[model samples]
Structures are given as structure tokens and as C-alpha cells.
Target: MTPPTPAIVTQSAVRPLPRWALLLLCIAYVVPGFVGRDPWKSADVTAFGYMLELAQQRTPWLAPLLGGMAPETEGLLPYWLGAWAIQITPSWLLSPEMAVRVPFAALLVITLMATWYGVYYLARSPGAQPVAFAFGGEANPPDYARAIADGALLALIACLGLAQLSHEVTSYLVQLSCTALLFFAVAAMPHRTVAPAIALVVGMLGLTLAGAPALATLLGVGSVVLVVLAPGSSTDRRLPWTLALAAITVVAALVAWKLDLWRWRIVGANSGGKEWQSLARLLLWFGWPAWPLALWTLWRWRKQIFSRQGHRHLLLPLWFSAVSIAATLTTQPADRALLLGLPALAALAAFALPTLRRSVGALIDWFTLLFFTVSALAIWVIWIAMQTGVPAKPAANVAKLAPGFVPQFSALALVVALAATAGWCVLVWWRASRDRAPIWKSLVLPAGGAALGWVLLMTLWLPLLDYARSYGPQVRAVQAVLGADPGCVQTVGLSRAQVAALQYHGNLTLERAGLQDECNWLVADMESWPASERMVNAARWERMAVVPRPTDKNDHLLVFRRAAR
Candidate 1:
């Protein structure tokens, strides 16, 4: 038997958030990082490298390679999407770097939309609805569901980990978006059929193509089990849906097998004390604010969660979140694996709103207000230090961290940052002065504060971040040593990101170390200098210069010019 739900919400507390404000908040969150940033270090640039290779017609469509090294991730759809975006966009209108980001940005937007709808459907479940009052003042189901959905979205945006990874053009973001779609399909299955069925197929197939066939299969099978075990699921009503889901799951598995995309990458959990502590830290901060609320939801919904009534509104998200958390423990890149669980976590967090006491909500509001205000002030101070050197220590820290960086001021960026600051102030005022009756009021400061910090960093600290995180400055230093039109440069032991940086920023043609008969210059990683000597005739090549990446002194390159015979 199902226990009484803990929620006792009223009609007044379910007031809808304005549609315009929600749209504007989403736009503010989605647009900034995609627009004015370089393809950053490691994964971001490496993925962009593969996409650039495909766009330049230098790599096969089925298999992309950079400097003869294939991408480490087992997915090709992300690269295809980026390459397609680059190919279709005219260069005069948008550079390939900017064009590649457009689709990933859309994927993030879709993830947000799918998450909202998924939470709405879950909140509409009979078991999740608020209690009826003797006076008939209980919150209407639709209004309450919408209010819950609004809170879920705000929680997702406020997760600290989501800001950076979601903005990158990587397979992980694709997987995350597809996971949200699958989650929506499963949650909406009982009430709808056609659209949910279509979403299920697309979601499953998308997961297969996006390098997470295992996750797709697990989630699909789990949904089937939940449906069969659900109360009042007459065999007649359940069998057809079960069979259809099973068929789609089988087809998805077959597609993955045919494409040879299956990879067993489980790296098991690390038992080392420090590694465990690091992971613990990651979990704590990465899901901040949301994690605490999710825990609160579980506590309040404990009886419903464990009851025989099969309260799927809680069960489904718990399953999804559990699967992702399990993967995070066993995976190599733990953070990306954990990212797939966030939408479900946020959904779980939303359910806590109906049960939270006034004191608890006030505590959340006060903590968020204090935390983000200090963060914003710190960013502003650093920016001021970089511009005018008003505070000596922050400027000194910047110079020490990113050596040889020349700071430049942009009036446009400053105006945007100031405008965002003003908007944040207005939002704080609204939250502080207005009635706190709305269920989502508690999350307003957290979401707005998160957006404010992101905007400030993207506008105020963009140049500094680019200089520290990007390969542009390093590439330019190499070009300075090579002079104009250094043709057909041979490379040895260069990383995929370095090769891509050279091609994009230096515009230099590259050949393998032993393969370039006509090349006059060679660039080799300092660590691979021995291999360079073995590959080339040492007498014919003379050392030119050793160029170090400004941010990392240990990471330097050896430049060589072919000696005149």
C-alpha cells in the first residue's frame, strides 16, 4: 500500500513563472560560451580538430583522423554534426570554429527542454499530486506540475558542472541530450503513445550513435521492467508497450553491433585514499545545491519510493540517476559519466519543493545569495585588477599564472558585463521584496546567480581564460620563429590538439616526420626529440629554437630548420 505523499501544497503556491523570463534566462545561459571562445585545450580542441579535418576533406567521412590519430571517444555522430555545420555555413558569415558550436548549443537547449517536460509529466502522476483539502484549495495538478518543472530547470542550470561541459562540442554532451530525451519518453509513456514512441526510438538510436550503447540498453530494459511491475498495468495494456520497447532496444543493439561501436571501457573503482577523496570532492561541488535537495526529496518520499504502489514518478528518476552514478564510479572520465545523471537529479530536486518548510527555503535563499554575490564580486575585482592594476595581488597572480599575457580591453564586453550585473541586481531585488509564495522562489537566486557568474566570466575574463586555456598564443609563437609562409612543415610527436592549432592558427601544411621530402622545417615535441633524430638525417636539420607554451613551461616544442646543403 502507498503511504500518504508528504506534499501539501496550495493553489497560491503554484503560480506560474512568467514565460518571457524563463525564455530570457535560457537564452542568457545558452549563448555566451558558444559565441566568443576559442576551442579550448584537451577535449574541446581535440574534438574540433577532428571536425576541422573532416571539413577540409582530409579525412574519411566514416572515420576521422587528426595527424593520423583517431579520436579517443568511440563516437562519430558529434564529429559529423560539427563537420556538417561547418560545411553548410559560409566562411564569410561564420568561421568554422563558430559554426561547429551551433549544433552543440542547440543540443544543450534540447536537453533543457526535454528535462523540463520530463519533470512536468512525472509531477503530473497521481501518486505525486498534492493532497485534497476540505476547503478545496489544493493546488491544481497542471499548475503545480508547471511550477515543479520550472524549479527543475533552475536546479539544472545551477549545477556547477553543467556550465563548462555542456558548452563543449563533444560526444558527452550528445549523450547527455539523448539521455534526457529517453528519460522524457519513459516518464510520459502511460499518458501518451505516438510522440513518446517516436522519442523512444530516436533516443535509443541516438544513444547508440553517440557512443553509449550500454547506457541506452540499460535504460530501455529498466523502463520495460518498471512498466511490467507497475500497478494496474493489465497484460493487455502493458504487453504491447513492452514488446515495442523490447523491439526498439534490440534494433538499437543490432545497429551498434553492425557498426562495431561497442567498447568495453570500464576502468573499475580506484581504491587509493587520495583518489577516493578527490572523487568525493568532485561529487560534493559538482552537484552542489541540487544534490542537497535531491537528498531531501528521497527522505520525504521514502515511503512512496519503497511502497508496492510503484510510484514511478520517483522510481524512474531514481533508476536513471542510479545508473549514471554507478557508471561514474566505474568509468575513466568520471565527470562526464556523472553529467548524464544531472537532469534526473534536478527532477528529484524539484519534488523536494512541495515538502520544504518555510525555514528550509529561507536558508537556501540566504546561502545562495551570499555565495554568488561574493563570487561575482571576486570576478569583478580580478577584471579591474587586469584592466587598471588597482589591486596589486590579483594582477600579480594573473601575470604569474599566465606569463607573457597582454591584457586588452573591449568596451562591448564591459558593457555586457555591466548590463548582466544590473540584471542580477534587479533579480535580487525582485526576490527579496516580492512575495515568496511561489514554489520556485527559493531557486530564483541560485539560477540567476549562476547565470550572472557565467556571463561575467565569459565577458570579463574571456581574454585571460583564452590566453591560459587556448593554444593560439603557443601557435603564434611558433609562427614567429618560422616567419611568413613556412611551407609543408614536418611534425613529430605532436598531439592532435597541437596539430589542429597549427593548421588553424598558423595555416601551415603538416607532414609526418619521415614522410616530408620537400619540407624545410620540422617541429617536434621536446619529449620526442630522440625520435626526431632517428627519423631525420641529423646533419641535414639544425635546431632553430625551443618554444615553450606560455602557461606551461615544461611543455615546450623543438623547432628545426633544414640546413642548407
Candidate 2:
């Protein structure tokens, strides 16, 4: 008998995802949590407010220019999108919440699509496909596994960094999503054609629009190098030259627009030398829990780290991590740098997953279970303590304490804890069954855990932040005293946080007080209280209220108002 010919795989024979299904999956993966809470105090809302004002023609395009902050700092694209959203949405539908969030929501969806495409292309690259096929085996082709892996990556991106940044309405998410697309195009480019050049242009536009001209220039240079150095025909040689010139021109234009020649003054200068070490610690904190696994993977894969095939896929993540860390170390506020590393880490995590599945798979599952269980317990305990008014750190030798002092916890806490524990158990059992399999076992626990964590944060963590955002009931109490009198409320010696909270949540327009008639209410910190009261030429106002400072200092909110007429 003649040997059967190997099945000829045609394009139609390969199952491709339906367009509608893909669109729905993208949406499902990328939608931000609609908790309707503003937790960053005012940064996000204030930026949106300015954008809204500009849209309403109350401000000029040069409004941001007044401060010399580029419209591109947060990227011009999202702002333009937000501006259009405000202009088109009916006034009744245009609440501060809706105005800021809608554009981000749309971008969030785009981010998911970008991530999926990036990972798919990266996996389907010539270097990657054989390994994927070998890992999957003929009995089960790797296509479905590849899709699932990409989906998991997309899901993780949406759940963790992307979700938080987009919902919080920061510029980081926009930049991150753009960077992902850039990497996708770079990885997927076929040598000896205009395809790589097109990808480079798209990436360059994305970076320019996302507000990082300097970094974008670097990426453009890298792209040229990648194309020129790729093993291919002589025709491919000319492509890089053309791409480099185009990228350079775009970079120059963006630089000019951002006024790169100007020397920007540093605000809130930190002269202390402790910042360098603090930044390192902060990086660890931000990377938290995820970095350990990433480090472990790197050590395990040290041999493959610099291999020819691995190098292409590895370059982007490595560069991303290095640049972000360097930036954080050099910057005044290190927290902002945390956002830069998230995408790199997420990508690294995705690449690391298969390896994890092959080795110590059971251990990872068990550890994850333990982590969730401990996390749930800790959250519940904290919730209970907060509800019962039990001091987190009680004073020694204190006397009077209340009766029936049992701590109370929210039902949500118990539900989350149980769910986490159950999920962990399920994951552990599933992994155990497939311990010997070469196939990629579905590891949904990490993604599920992240999702659950986000829910907890939105519902529980945000409400706690409300205390800080509400100006410690200062705004509410002031309103009670003033009762809608125009110019009746003013703040004295307020911190930026206090002023911001007043502006965003209280719906008040505030300016510094020069004279008593400037406004009625005055808020002051302890040190500045005397100066503020003196500046306003007021003896004292009604003692409206007092609240503890939201942070870890023995601070109090002493709300004094000018006597009501």
C-alpha cells in the first residue's frame, strides 16, 4: 500500500476566529471596571476638566501652553478623543465621570486588540512556530493553544496595568497600548517589502501621538536596525534607509512642537539624597509579587536569553524594563515610572508562562493558592478592624475601651475570601491532573485572581479613599454652614491634595485668598492656620468640624468658617 500523503494544510482548512467573535472578545477583555469612583484625588479629573473646558471654548488650545506643558505630554490623541466626546455627547449625559471615562473605555478596547495581535504575531514568527508546534504535538495542533495563550496575555493586560491606568485616566495607558502595537509590527514585519516600513510608520505615529518623541526616536532607530540587519535579499537594504529618514523627520517635528530646546524648571525639588535608594525599593514594591516570578523565569532561561532566536522576541521587553527602571531612578517622583514597567513585565510574564507550565507547575499553583488565601484573610482582618474602630496600632497603657468590641467585617470581604480560596483549590487540582502533559494546560488562576483583586479594590479600597477625597467631610460641613451662599467658602493654607479634592468632588472653583472679602470659608493646615486667619483679617469662624488626616501622621482637619451673616 502506498504511504498516505501528509495532509495539505490550506488556509481554509485552518480555523480562523470570526470577526464578530473577535470583536466581542476584544471588548469583553478590555472594558474598564465602571466603578464610578475617582480615587487619584484630582489629577485625572483636573486634566479632563481642562480638556472639557477647552472643548466648551472656555479655554484655549494654548491653555496647556500657558504652563508650557505639551499637549503631547499626556498625548494629543486621547485628549482629542475626549474633546470630541464632550462636544458630541448631550449636556445631560456629560457628567465629569462620563466625560473623562468614555474615551479611555474606547482606548481600553483598542489596547486589547493590539495586545492580541502583538502576541499572535510574535508566536507565529518563524523562530517561534516550530517550538510552538513541537510543544503542541500533531495530535493537537498549536493554533488553538497559541490563540488561548494570546487571549490570556490580552486578558492579563486588561486586568492589571491597562485596566487600572485607563480607568484612572492617566497618559500611561495610551503610551503603553501604542508601544505594544509598535512591538507587534516590529515582530511581524516580513523582510524585503514595504510591510516593515509601514509598521514602523504606524509605530512612529503612535509614539508621537502618545507623547514620547525622544523614546519614539530611539524605537525608530531600532526598527531600522532590525530591518537592515535581518537576513534577506539586497532589496531589503534600501528599505531601512527610507524608514530611517522618515522617522527622523517625524521625530524632529514632534521635538519642535514640544519645544525640546527649552529648559523646563523643576517644581517641588527634592534636594535630599535619599531618593536614589528609595526609587530602587519603590521599583520592587511596584513590581511586587510579579517580579519574583519574572526573575525566576529569567534565571531558568538564562541559556536561551541571548540565543539568536530568543533575542528578537526578548529585545523589546529587555529594553522596556531597562529604560523604565532608569527613568524611574532619575525622575523626581518614582511612582510614575511604575507604569512604564508594567507592559514589559506583562509581556515577560506571557513568555514565561509555558516554561512555568513545564517545570514546577504544581508548585506555582500551590503557591498561588496560598497567596490568595493569605490575601483574603488579610483583607478581611483589616476590614473588620476598620469597622470596629479598633486602632491599627493601639497605644500602650490605654484605659477606657468600648463593650461588645468584636470587629465587624463587610459581607463582601467574606464572599471574596471564600471565592479566592475555592478558585485556588480548583486551579491546584486541575494542574495536578495535567502535570505530565506536554500540552499547555489552561492556567486561568492568575488572570482570575487579578480580576477578583480588581473587584475588591473597586468596591472596598475605593470607598476608603473616599475619606481622603471628600476633604475629610470639610466640604460637606462647609456646605452645611454656608448653605449655597456665593463666595462663602474659601480654603486657607490648604495642601495641593486638599485644594484638588475641593475642586473636583466639591464642585468649587478656588483661588488664593488675598483679603477677607475674597471668600467666606477658610481651610488651613496647622502651621499655616495663624497666617491664613491673619491674612483673611478674620478673628475666627465657627468650628465646623474636625477629622483625622488620611495619611500616617497625627494630623487633624480643623474646619473654621467666617461667621455666617
Candidate 3:
């Protein structure tokens, strides 16, 4: 090297991922925390809050109250984990909100890793490396293309949904992660013997934990299909039968267990039902804004459906998407349904990336940038309107901020940064095209866009969102009024929403007032306070304080201290 660097050595100099690209992707993955308010009002959040309280008391094995009232719900796994996190983390370091969410964040990270691995395998199977590397003639495709694709996949994992899910603790998040892992495992299994065996074990575990076996059954069937459809010789034929038998046995066992478990019903327990319309609506909501691209990609690749390369990675995503949609449609809540499509959409979106032209790609990039930028600005505008003593005209306000609020300047910065990165990407593509190396250019735009999107979301978008949703002031108000003693306070006719907010932000425990004499203090909504006739005659309670509603009168906090005590 000292004598004179060889031509090959000079040409092979390593190129690192651009600093700005890395920063953007990291921001996107982590930034949801910024915009997302804590899990204050959500039913799942309330359930976890109760669980965390139980765990804080060292009752890690027990399921906490469902919906902060019902005791009959199953699946104490998330609760146990939350409890464990609470126990290990320092008291000051953990808010009840943060305690429950730690698991979500950890699982999200795992999902990202699984996604990378899955995409790597999928890319390899499709001869993505070979196709990407192939020059105009007999020359080999550049090695950098493979590295770039891998990086782009990683960037996709650090998406907007990941941030939102990680901020809100929910079983759906866990199920999504498990689902991704299951598919990854299935897709990676090449051999007949290993594939079914692995699918059986992983499939069982995932279905059991996900609280959805029908979907798991679909996944198992799809895996078998993949095996049958695989292009190998006679050996592949025997694989499907073996896998089918094993899957049947496992699924049958799971169904039996589920039936027996559901026989004795408690409050808040899910009773299976049919809701086809809701399912359709859920699917529509989940697919919005991004569904068009996903659908386009699938349509274009329809011919590849039966091809050997296409079938290899197809079954898992298809089964997962189909079953998840079906199951969510049948269930009561639709939000959870969004999670089922994440893996499929992400993978499908990745496939579409390679096909987009430079102009088209730039348009998509700009659209996302503009979407976030406008969103951020809208939030600030709303805040300004609210602050400047604007009359509360719900209809007018709705008309004005039709779509919704946007983040502040800090939030808008994410969009600006993305636009800049996209500009750079166009330049890179232009350079590559000039050199007659368009294939290499494919990797550049996607990689740059993904990286930029990630950064914008994580750093600017998340922080702004979190700040907007935080209930720190509300927590402070409660604490100032009520002393720190857990035994002194009680909540009366409190909604689960209020209970969750108090539990998460204020570290307050709420107990139902069985008798008027049971409580020293009562926190209740003025509108819903029980009639005086319902009070026990001997015990006296008087309203001592009222915290005026910050945002709405319906939310005023009326505090009653014992007149007798």
C-alpha cells in the first residue's frame, strides 16, 4: 500500500452509511414517544396500569383487574413482565406509564431485528443480490447493492407504526412481534424435516400467546403450502404431509385448551362473535394512505404468485395478513387489527421500492415529508387557537383543522430533513443514471429515503407528539391536593379513563367506595357523583376542593374530604 495502492484496492474503498441517513432512521424509530401521550385513556393501558400496581406489590404471578374492574381476563404474561420491569427499575426512573411500556419497546426492537433477518432471506431467495448486481452485459452486480438493500430493510423497521406501538403498551404489539418472528423462522427453513418441525413448535407458541389460534392455524397451513409448492425434487413432497399432521395435532390441542378455558367466563372476557362489517372497516382504516402502494405492488407481481422464487416467502405474509384480518374483523376492537397487516405491508412495501422510478420515488418521499410537515404545523396552530382565547367552536375548529393538528417547528424539521435527504437521493440517482448504472441507483434512493424518514419520525415527530399528550400537569394537580398516603384516597364512580390517567401519571390507586364510611377522601366527576340519598346516613363527607377542568368541564376533578374523620 505504501509503494502504491493497487487499482483494485483503490476502487474498493469502503463507503459508510451517511451520517444524516442514520440519524433520520434512528429518529423515526424512536420519535413516536415525542408525539404519543402516555397510555392514559386506553382500555389496554388501564389494564396494564392495574397489573403494574399488582406487580409493584410483588404479586408478579397474578393477573391484575381487567379494565381496572373486571377480574376474569386471561393472559397475565404482559402484566408479569411489566411487574418485573417495575421491580428492577429504580422508582424515580419508572413512571407507571413507562413501566408498562418498557416491554413494548423491547418487543419492538426484537421485531425490527426479525424483520431485517426475514427480508435478508427473502432478498437472497429472489436472487435480489444477483439481479441488483448484474451489469448491462456479463459484468457482476455491485456488492454495495446488497448492503444497501439490507440497510433499507432496517430503515423500514424503524417506521411510524413502530414508534406509535412502542409508546402504547398493548398485547397487539407483542402479538405483532411474535408474528414477525414466526414468519421469519418459517421462511428461513429450507429443509422438509426442519421446516415443519420448527413451524409446529413456533406456531403453537405464537398462537397460544397471541390469543388467536385460528390465525395460527392459517399460518401453519400456509407453511405447508409453501413446502408443497417449493420447487425441489421428490423429497419436498413428503415434507408437506409431515408438517400437516404435526400442525393438525398442535392446533387440535390448542382448540381444546381454548374451549375449556373459555367455558367458565368472567367479566371482560372475549366471547367470539361475527362482525364482518367491522372487520372490513378495520381493514380499510389500517390500510389507508399506504394501501394503494401495497396493492399496486401485489398486482404487478401477481404473475410471480406461483413462481418458485415468489412462493418461497409468500405463504407466511399472506397467511398472516389474511388470518389477522379475519380474526380482528370478528373481534370487538379494530385498532388491534392494524398490527396484523404490518408485516405484510412492510414486506410488500419493500418489494415495491425497487420498482419505483426516480421521479415516482421522489414524489412518494415528498408526499410523506409534506404529510408530516403539515401535521406538525397543524398541531401548533390548534395550540395557538386554544391559547389565544378563541371561542370553542367545535364545528369551525373541525373545519379549520380538517385532517388534524401538526407538530411545531421541531416537528416540521423532520420533514425538512427528509426533503433534503430526498434531494440528495435524486442527485445520487442522476449520477448513477449518467454512469449507465441504474440498478445501483435503485438502492440509493430507497436507502436514503428510509434513513431520512426514520430520523424525522424518531427525533422531531416523537418528541413533539409526546409533549402534546403528556399529563404531567394533571398529575401534579392531583398530588398537590392529596397527600402521598395510598390509604387516604378513593375514587367514586370514576371512569376507566380517569382511573388509568391517575394511575399512570399520578401514581394513585383507586378503590371503589363500597360504603360511604370506607373512604377518607373521594375523587369523583361532579356530573356522576351519587345522589345524597345513596350515602350511608351516619358518615359525613363534604366537597373540600375542586380542580377546574383544564380542557373541558365534563372532566372537572371534585375532591371530597371526610367531614366525620
**Please, what is the TM-score per model?**
0.97, 0.72, 0.70
Q: Mind giving the per-residue lDDT tens digits that candidate 3 earns over 107-128? A: 7765665665565455454333
* lDDT per residue as tens, model 1, 411-439: 99999899989999999899888588999
Candidate 3 local lDDT, residue 556: 68
Top candidate (lDDT): 1
Model 2 scores a TM of 0.72
lDDT of each prediction vs. the true structure?
0.90, 0.51, 0.52
Alpha-carbon runs more than 4 Å astray in model 1: 232-237, 532-534, 537-539
For candidate 3, give the lDDT: 0.52
Backbone clash count, each prediction separately? 0, 3, 25
For model 1, which pairs clash?
A: none
- Number of the candidate with higher TM-score, 1 or 2: 1
Ranking by TM-score: 1, 2, 3
Best-performing candidate as measured by TM-score? 1
- In terms of lDDT, the poorest run of 10 residues in model 3 is 1-10
